[model samples]
Target: MTMEKLIRFAALAFFSIAPMAVATAQDSADYHVTVTLNWTEAAFPVGFPEDPHFSRFIGMTHNERFTLFADGQTASTGLGLVATNGRVSILKAELGEMTRRKRIGSVVEADALKAGAGVVQMTATLTSAHNRFSFATMVAPSPDWITGASGIVLNPDGPWLESLTLPLWVWDAGVDGGQTFTSPDDPLPVKESVRLAATPYFLHPAGLLPIGTVVFVRVR
Candidate 1:
């Protein structure tokens, strides 16, 4: 081949391969998440239970197409299990399906907070394609109350936030009719949309107080 022709072919090959490389390259960031539960009787004196505690926490790093839980939406069977029974096996299976479908990047789980006031930490990896996070945990001994945050964007624009804190509010799974912490299992005849807990249990004299907080800090 002629020198000019060889040079032209080489340039075309490099440009084509460069575009493919750029398309396949994905930027990822690591974060350390700290979940602190403040559901002490001191902070929430109303209707304090005997053993105030939080259930096992489950979270996901996902893209815009996925949601762990959302307000005004019906709870999935797996989420219902968490809220009603503080179980994670079914939810983990659901997350596995989501992973197979490429809807989520990672599933993060943590040990339960045995006391009302404690902290649980976990690490997560977020890619540019999946920069949002969602998490949830049940209010132990409750009928169907849960606490969590959903649709949180770790990287809104191009840069990841150094640190972000989100207040955790109690939500009703709408799967049970029992209102108290130790109420017996009473499944609702029809499912209701998930929403913030409005029962007197969570209501304070001042207003609704958050039960916990989740803090995300970029580690790398």
Candidate 2:
């Protein structure tokens, strides 16, 4: 099926069966998570000549020690790959190390998406030590731009009983020169750590355009 159609179908199916899919995962698997990244027409950034785009999603469920990125932290070699080139190989391999060490629970990846919306789902094994989740994707044709979630908690005080949704925003990978798209000198490292973009685009404030939505559902 076409990507747009598939996204719509996935959303529909989720909402349609969600009421019946809330069984406790302790009975079988650990956790069943369905994460959807969406960009509605109304939420699309304005005053841009072209539509924004996104790289494939790369997500992980890990322990407290496994950090993806923080506002003031250094961007890892893996994060640099996605933020600069829309690539996931390096990040996946890096995360694989944590998997072997049992520092992380699971890692998930999905295909690149166009200017609109897309959905990617992952299943996570439950553990008190590894209860945080993080996911990210690159915004293309810009200098080290990205959007994702970090340190999302599951079953904080009790069993996870409700679905959660969070608004996505753009982030600067801090390795860029903050120049125009495809600029040769762009993304020149400033020796600075990762942080939010100072300006996401010309018309919108930092990290505000093409405002994406991320939905997390517990389906086990």
Mind giving the per-residue lDDT tens digits that candidate 2 earns over 1-220?
A: 9999999999999988876665533322344555455554455444332555778888888888888988889888899888988899999999999999987888877677776556656666555567778988887767787888888887676666356777777777878775555556465645468776655352344434535566666655
Which residue pairs in candidate 2 have backbone atoms (N, alpha carbon, C) closer than 3 angstroms, thus clashing? 176-187, 177-187
Find the candidate with the highest TM-score and give its number. 1
Q: Give the TM-score of candidate 2.
A: 0.74
Instruction: Point out where model 1 deviates above 4 Å.
Output: 1-26
Instruction: Report how far off residue 51 is in candidate 2 (Å).
Output: 5.6
CA lDDT of every candidate = 0.89, 0.71
Residue 103 of model 2, lDDT score: 79
lDDT of 1 by residue, 110-134 (tens): 9898899999998999898789988
Local error of candidate 1 at 50, Å? Answer: 0.3
* Candidate 2 residue spans exceeding 4 A from truth: 1-51, 118-123, 200-210
